[model samples]
Structures are given as C-alpha cells and as structure tokens.
Target: MSDDQDQEQDQDRPAAPGPGELSPEMKRSNVRFALTLPLFFMIMFPLCYITALHLPVPHDLPVAVVGAGAAAFIASAAPALAGKFTLVPVDTPQQATDMIFQQTVKAAYVTAPPGQSAHMLVAGADGRVMTQLVPTVFAPFAAQAGNTVQTVDVAPLAPGDGNGIGLMFFMLIVCIVGFMTANILGNAAYFLPMRTRVAISAGVAVLTPIVLFLFMGAWLQILQGTVGQIVAVIALGAVTSFTVGLATTALVAFLGKWALFPGMLVFVFLNIPSSNSAYPAEIVPPFFGWLSEWHLGAGFVDAVRAVLYLDGAGLGGHLLVIGLWFLAAVLLVGAAAWRKRAAAAGEADAGDEDGEGDEAGPAGAAASGAGPERVLLGRVHDHHGTPLPGAVVTLVDHRGTQTGRTSTTDEGGFRIDDLPTGAYTLIEAAPGHEPAARATVVDHHGGGGHGGRVGDIRLVAHEEEHRHRAAVATDGTVPPSAGSYGGS
Candidate 1:
C-alpha cells in the first residue's frame, strides 16, 4: 500500500477508548478524595463542638459587690466561691450599674439597706445561661443574711427574641453565605480578573448584611438596639462577610479543590465554638476562651453584643481585631494573584525557548534527508475563547504511560516533539478549571512537518464542568472526550 493510503487508514482508526474511561491512578485518586472529605468532617465537627461545649464551668467570672462593707463581705465569702467568681467591691449600687454598663463585670450584687431584700443586677443580653448562673452563685449569701434576692435585668433581650441569641444565628447565616459565595465565584468565575472577583465579593459583603439586618431587625423585631447601634452591628456584619469571603477566596486561589477543608476549619469549626454566642467565654474550656479573644466570629459577636447591650463597651478592641483580619485576607489574596501571574510569565518565557526549533517546518527536515519529527502542538483556551496561559498539557499513550508534559505559553500555545508514532491521549488542565482530554493519532507518515495539531482545546471552569457532568448523569448521555489518562 502507498504511504498516503497507510496514513489515511491510521487516521481513520479510533485513537482511544470511548468517553469516561478512567485510568487506575485516577480511580484511586477519586476514592481517596471521597473518603478524605467525610473523615475530615467527622473529626472536625466533634472535636471542636463537643470539646468546647461539653461541660461549661465559669473561670473567674467577674461580679461586683456593692454598698459599704462589700469588700469585707466578699473576702469572707471568697472561700465558698473560689475559682468560680472574681468578685470586686464597689462603694455603691450606682457604681456597680456603671461597671455593668461598661462590661467591666458580668453582674453585680447589692447589699440591702436595713430591711429591704438585696438586689442582683444582671444583663440578660449576655447569654441567658450566664444571667441565670450569676444569681444562683450569689443565692447562698442572700440566704445567710435572712433575705431573698430580687433579680433585675439591666440589659434585657428584645421581647421578640426569647433566647437572646437571634443575632448570633443571624451572624452565622451571614458568614456561611459569604463563604459559599466566594467559593462559588472562585470556581465558576475563574476566568474573571482578580480585581473583578474581589469587587464581587465586596458587593456580596455589603448586600448580605443589609438584607439580613432588615429581616432580623426590622421585620422580626428581634434586635432591640437604637438606630445607630443597629447600624454599628450592620457595619460589623459587613466586615465579617467581607473578611470571611476574601479569606476563603484566598484559600481557593492557593489550594484549588482542597480549599474547603481549611476554609471550613477556620470559619466554621474554630469560629463557632469560640464565638461565645451560646455560652460566655469564661464559662467554656480554656482553649476556646483564649480563641474568643481573637477569633473572627468572636470579634463579631463581641462587637455586636457591646453595641446592642453594653453601650458600646470594648467596641474599639473588637473592631480592631476584625479589621486586622480583613487586612490579612486582603494581603493574602494579593499575594496569590501575584504568584499566579509570576508563574504564568515564567512558563511563557520557557515555552518561547522551546518553540525556537519548531520554526523550521517538517518539510525542511525531510529535504535534509532526516526523518520527520513527530511533534504534537496545540493552543488552549478558556470557555470564553481567551488564551489560558500556564495550562498544563500532558500526553499519555494507550498503555497509560505519560510520554510528555508541557505548559502553555503567553499565547496559550504548547509543543511536544520527538514522539514515536502511536495513538495517545492529550490532557489539558489548569488551576480552578476542569481538566479535559481528547484522543489523537500521531503518524509520522502523514506528510506534514509536524505529526499532528489537535486544534484549539477549550477548558471549562469547575462550576460549569460540574453542571455539565450533572446533566450528563441525569440523562445518561456521554460527553465527548471525557476520558482520563495516568500521570507520572
């Protein structure tokens, strides 16, 4: 048979198995990823929640004793309440009230004037559990004096909010929605510029808080702060959303598909247990109490509580911590973008050097009496048809052995030369994008200087690819070139 006829026959034959063919290595990788996710959730959920919340005992919970001889009274009662209450002596009831408003003390006990029952002042805005616990701890002293205690709630929760934790639940919803929004943008909008993604996140941050504030504060009437105080809480919510979203985006940029593990670890696992929303920090375990001092959620909860109930006590410190988080996340995202741009520039430069010899066509080599080089080349593009620089192109033969690997140039072009004629799979992959594969025949006898050119290979962003796969699964329709090959 003539060489032309043989080449045509080779081209006509099927180059690889049908779509959805997975190599052994790919199967193992999929299984490992699947198992790792459930295990991660199992360990993190129980470890953080159960450990922090199992048994809550107050550690040096601050309380004030008011009126004359209060110091002597506390000193006499110290042994009974050792390690549980940190009692301070105040000269009068007014001073104790001032201390409570400033959040210097959680609650206060006032000694009765000659015959009246003693007063126990508590802030119901500080979780109800803490409010209830305070009076119980001071009940013995009141009983010894042959007087009962009259509990007064200085800062009470809104009548609509029975549990006083509505804001905490609202903050959690805002945070989780912000986090998921950023994650979705990272995967689905991978082709957008970094600044655009950041802007989108900022928009979400602003909008989420305002909408939730209207629902939880205006519509539900669960929040009982003044207009300015409510605005302050809304501002804090915006900061929380922006900070968490940007932090999650940075993680996604650096870790790709594995970003969720650390993102959830920081924002959900650690943040929730230490937030002091359900229990006061002093009542929880020491580790979580320490975390409450600086953790992101803790800062939000503290600042909101201060604004709504404590007359903005300790507000500056909590805002400072949250601001620091926003700053750190901004820096991390900038670094990720810079790193990606630098790596792409380096790969483009390398691709240029590798392409130098390819300018001489295969015809030139054939004329020189040397055998034609078996080179395979192509350009990669995103779903929008823009060049995708730094995309990885890997070649694997029918035996599942990787034959060559190269990254795309600034123009999204790549070349792999000196291959033995065979049927092979070309795999294209890039960060935050779904990998794609197609089969092609590389026959030296095809009469061209290059063995083959697979045309432009387009890759879809992860979200789009996922949707496509879901559609395919539902209809039992096979997508073209959905096969995976082994890698070295």
Candidate 2:
C-alpha cells in the first residue's frame, strides 16, 4: 500500500511494446492469419454454403422413360420444366431400370396403364435431394394424365444413413482433413526438401484415411460400408484432397503468397459447392452439375456411394477423377520445385560474382573512382529455365529516374555499370517472352564494395505467362510492379 510497494510492483511489470516494435513478418502474419483468414472463412463459408443450397432447381437432368407415350409426354412438358429433364426413350421398363442402376440416368419414368397411377423409379442412394426431386419433376406429367405419381426407391440408402447425406458429410470431412493436412505439412515443414514433403504427404494420406475409417466407420458406424470398402474410399479421398493442398502450397512457393487466391477459388469455392455433397448435382446449377462430374469431392462422394449401395458399377470413373487430380497436383508441385532450385542457383552465382569482386582488392578499385558506379548484374531465363540470350535489360531508379540500359549476351547475362547507389527497378524484355520486373537495392560502402546484384530474371514465354506485361519498350519506364520475385 506504500510508495515502496508500488515501486517494487512497477519494477516487476512487463514493459510495453515500443512504437514500430512489431516486425514486418509479425504484422503480415497477424494480418493473414488472425485477421484475414478468420474474416475470409466467416464470409466465404456461409456464402458458399447458402448460395449452393439456396433455390436449387433441376437443370438438364437426364432421365430414362419407358412405355410408348412416356417419352413424348416428357418431350412435350420439357419446356414447362425449364429444360430440367433430358428424357431418354428406352424400349422397356427393364432397360430404364438398368440405366438407373448404371447411373446412366438419375431416375426412370414408367408410364402407367389407362386409369392407373404412374410409377417413378428413383434411386435414394443417388442422394436424398435427387430422390425427392424426381417426384416433383414427374408430378405434372402424372397429373396431366389424370394419374398420381408414385416414387419407388429402387436403390435405397443404408441404415442409419439419414436421407443418404451421411456419405456426403463423410466425403466433406475427408476433403477438409486431406487439404488441411497438406497445408499444415507444407507450412510447418517448408524448410524440408520437396521430395520429403511429398513423401510425408503420401504417409499422411495413407494414415489419415485409416484413422477416419476406424472412427467414422468402425467406431461411429455412421458410414454404411464394409471395412475394405470404407478403407478404399477413404484412401482415395484422402490422397486426392492432400494433392489439392500440396498443389496450393506449391503455388505459394512458386508464385508467393498472392497465389492463395486462385488456390482457394479452385479448391474451396469452385470445388466444394459443385461437389454434389451438399445437394445433388441435378438440383444445383448447370455449372455446379458439370463440375460435380469431375471435381475431387464430388468424385469421392460418388465413388463412396457407388461402392456402398450401387454395387460399384461406375466406381472406376470417380476413381479416375481422383487420380487425375493427384497427377496434376504432382506436376504443379514439381514445376514449383524446379523454379525454386533455379532461383537458388541464380542467387548462388550472383553471390560468387560478388565474392570474386571483393577478392579483387577494393582499395585499388576505389582509387579508380569510376564515378561511384553501382553495378547491376543479372541473367534472363525462359519458362523452362533455359538461359535466354539477346534479351534487353533496363534499369530505373526509385525516383522515377531512368539509368543503365543493356542487353543479355549469349549466356543470358547483362550488366549495368556507373550509377548512383539507391533502390532500382530492373526490367527484362525479350521477343516471344513476357517481360519481367525485379526490384533491386544498391548500397555501396565507398570502395569497390559497390556491388548491386539483381540475380535472376525469369521471363515466361508469351504463351505461358498468365499476367499481362507492361510496355518495357519505352525509355526504361518500368510499369509492372515489383512483387514476390524481386531480384535483389
């Protein structure tokens, strides 16, 4: 209670953070993780879910029709249905039933006898949404014929699998785990070699499904599938999801943090809603329905459902979708790794040049007094990283001042000498290649230590570069902003 006690407490208290004390890295981390990620999830999660589920109406849904008049009735009423049903005429009800079992059609419409109710053979195993939708779609036709429509679930959902959505939820969980696991591995173990990361991904892919199968299948009994069946579906789903994450992470490695946009757009936005897990593809929009045919989540869900209830008739197609995604991801990650290695080698070469210059006696060079020149050195490479010769290189200082202009020699090397020390923008332009801009910093401690290295400038081929290049043909007017690939 006394002044002495207060003084002792003040001494024990922690110091406040000083002004500008937060490192740039810390600020960026908070902005990306604490602020951005939470906001993104909060906004996108609800938006994606609500938008995907809201007002789902059938569009171009294929159905098999039996009997002489059924196909004609569907064709006549198709306009009123907003092109919702694509009716395929079958010779007999058995043919329609076979098509439904093969998943060639979502449902089968059997024409009723005169003065009798019409029967619609639906597959509850396709999805609760689809099963429910069939009746709604056919009710009008049945009404026009003065007959009530009866929906008979030809392929039924498993026990405890309420409305057949259990499998969808299971697929969603597997996808989330698979991608999130890959992301965690990519970030936490980023310092490790790519091959090691890939191996780790494979191991995680194997282990995660095993755990999921035990929990969701054996322990929970929510998924109605045999042990082997569950294991296969889980494995395929995990591997596919992990590959998605790996590809996103590799993009970050190659294109830097900004690549997260496309990655999330593809995997989360475009992939999930279109996955046909939340709603049947037939009920959702045409775009989503199309995506459901090949998207990883949809493929997994289809495979799981087929194996569990449809006797695995069309499982291979879904499995093929998963495999293709995995292959594309592997290729993307491989390309990123190659670029990383090339960039590192370029840096090493630049560092070696600086070392050699340093060894050439700074005192003697200082005596030469060549107008305090800040030398800019770098090399140009094509998309595959082959050195590009005859490339034009230009430099502009931070103050919008243009300076050193040169061209690459046979080895894709260029140098600009005799410039005041400051920040600069380096631009590489070559015919048939996209121009690239790199920011450089030139700091000279008086003496021949006036070395400013721009390392490597990779110019993607015109056809391959996704970004639009600025006009580098002008008087060293650097237009494209310096981003993740800043050279120096």
Candidate 3:
C-alpha cells in the first residue's frame, strides 16, 4: 500500500523549473536590460527635479572688497563684494571710515588711471572661491582697458576652509545632500488625489533647496559669498534634485519595478561624472566637457563661478536650460498619469448611468459563478459621441491582476472580452488625457469566446494636449561653446 500510494503522489506533482535552461535570446535580453537600465534612469530620473533658481550661493558673512583700481575690478569681483562693500572706481585712496558708512563695497577700491603703475587694494573675506574668481574676472577686463589690477585680502580664511578649494567642497556637499533628501521624498508616497498630490509636491519642492542650502552653507561655512548668493546656489541644487526624483517616479511606474537601483544608477553615473565642479570641463577629456555643457552640473558650475569667481556668470542660458528640462518632464509624466486615470473613470460613469436606467440585482450578476462573463457593456467616445481610436484599456480583476485588453473604436465605442462573468475592474490610458478606472462584470455566460462584451470607453484629449511645448524654441543652432562665443 505505501509503495503504490507514493508512486501515485509522485505522478500528480508539477514539473520543476529547468536547471540552467535560459535560452540565448533570454540571456541576451537580461544582459541588455542590466546595462541599459542604468543608462536610462541615469539620464531621465535626476532630470525631472533640476532647476536654475535653486542653485546656492552662500549668504551672510564678513566680506571686504577693497580695490584701488577701475570699476571693472568691482564688476569682475561682483560675487566677492562682501557686506558693506566699498568700491573706489577712480584711483584714489578710500578712507576706512567711509567704507564703514554707506557700505560702498565690502571694502574700498581706488583704481590707478591708465598708464599708471600697478597698485593693489587690500581686503579680506572668509571664502576662498571668491578670492580665486575675483582676480580672474578683473584681470581680463583690466588688461583690455589698459590698466593693472592687484588684489590683496587682509582677512584670514576660516578654519574649516581650504586654501582655494572651499567652493568645490560646498558644491559637492550641496549635491550630496540634495540627492539624499530627494530620495527620502521619493519613498514616502500615498494614494492621494492627483491635484492634492501636486500641491503637496510643490510645497516640498520649494522647501528642499532653501533649507538644504541654508543649513549646509551656514553650518559648513561653505563659501564666503554673501548669504543671498549662497542661498541662491543651494536653491538651484534642490530644484535639480526634485525634478530628477519626479522623473524617476514616472520611469519606475512605466517599468513596473522598484525605484532603488534605477534611481541609484542615475544619481551615481551621469550626475556625478558630469558635475564638472570637481574638475573644470576645459581640462578634462572631450566627453566630460561636452557632458558638462548639458547637465544640471553645468549650471551648477557656472553658478559656482558666479558666486566664487564673481565674473563668469552665463546664468541666463544655463538656468534656462535646467528650467526647461524640468518643465518638459512634468508635462510628459503628468500627461501619462492623467491618461491612465481618465480611462478608469470612463468605465465607472458608464456603470452609474446604466444602473439608473435598468435595475439589475447583484445576486443575478453573481449567480453565473462570475465565470468569464460580461454582465455589462459600455462605450467610450468624445462629448459628441464620436468614437476615438488608439486608446488603450487595461482590465483588472478583484485581485488586481490585469485580465482584459483592447484598443479604441473604429466608429466610436469599446468592447471588453474574455473574462469571468463576475465583477471586475478596468483601467484606461491615453496620452494627453486624464486617467479613469471602474469596476464591472463581463459576458461570460456563453463560454470564454462568446462571453466578450462591448462597453464604450470614452475619453477626451486635454485641450492643452493639442499643442506640445517646444523643447528648443529657437530655430537656430546654439552658438558654439566657449571659443566660438568669442570669449575664453
């Protein structure tokens, strides 16, 4: 009896998965997915949250910009012009008392006229980034104007600050902090209405950069630039992170996967290498520099240059690029989500309308064992009842497993088929349309094939969707970089 029973039990068991049996095509796909996945998220995720305004520039500090030279020096040293800056445009010595008064420049500067001997003004500020850039900005202008400009700082650097590397430290810190904070937000999500979620997101989005920049610069004494400037740069960092994080969410949803590795790949590879803050793109390989020109880091680099060097801004274009990227990501992701929601809603409205017209008991609907049956039929169309094409419908069951699928009407309605006759859920999706979902039953009484039911799934494309925003508004090619722009 025992042997016979064991043989019978063994025959009833399911076959096991094959060992090392992955096909060549499957292996290649897995390998490609492993490689391409990182590249996709790296570029797309961080792209959503970036913004130009959030860039940080250290604010609040004792800075003295004293110059005995032309006003061009002051202009070149605009970023480093510390509190109560004193600018002596003409080549005359400025009194210390006067500098203490109107705050004319952080310190005072008296420029020597053209053909005059070189003379340097002495002033000190806590930041070294500013120190390096002030000289660079003024040097070119002075040389062009036929004057010699010399700078001397009387104030000493802070204990935490490096000789000339503090700004780089701040930039690195800002990026690191922003990236982590963004990750935290990406994790804490819930099922709130779309509009409410957007509002909440905007608030969080606004605060992330402001707080991070202020906390880091103030705590670390990251830069000696004015408090306002530091705050600006920090803001830039935060905006960049938020946009990136949101885009990351969209991608994860589309891939129907966890957000971790894809997000990490984005933060690590493309974001870090192309930062261009660690090393100027100019000195790096062609690829590094080229990448720098496009990434948020490029704006960050230019921003740091503005806050530290005080001369090489290019803020308008750099910030514009970052802002535009975020704008585009928001629209793209928002549109996709909207479409999914609208389709689901369409099915729900059909059910409600049908209920009022012809009463049907739940018991009767349930009696057919809810077998692959369609107890309901509906149609989706424009307000004028014209059937639309190319709409995608996703069918979900009680357990949330998708069971049915179809496209839009040739005339203007929809039919959902091949399901148990019981209650089920439907989700519809279309680009540029708000998403809609609902629960319903199928026509399964006639068996699997015959059970298919037609229900119109109607959706209207958003008015805004009629025209997409321009990624490149200008018809012209970008003026060639640095050299071609006519200034080095």
Candidate with maximal TM-score: 1
**For every model shown, what is its TM-score relative to the native structure?**
0.71, 0.65, 0.41
Clashing pairs in 2: none
Q: How do all the candidates rank in terms of lDDT, highest first?
A: 1, 2, 3
Best by lDDT: 1
TM-score of candidate 1 relative to the true fold? 0.71
* lDDT of candidate 3 over 385-409, digit per residue (tens): 3545566767777787877787655
Candidate 2 stretches greater than 4 Å from native:
1-22, 25-35, 255-261, 357-488
Q: Quickly count the clashes in candidate 1.
A: 1
lDDT of each: 0.70, 0.63, 0.44
Of candidates 3 and 2, the better by TM-score: 2
Model 3 lDDT, residue 343, Cα: 37
Off by over 4 Å in 3: 1-160, 163-204, 256-262, 307-312, 342-488
Flag the better candidate by lDDT, 1 or 2. Answer: 1
RMSD of each: 13.1, 17.2, 19.6
lDDT string, candidate 2, 23-90, tens digits: 24334654765576667777776666667778878877888877877766767776776677788888
> Which is superior by TM-score, 1 or 2?
1
Candidate 3 lDDT trough over 10 residues, lowest sum: 478-487
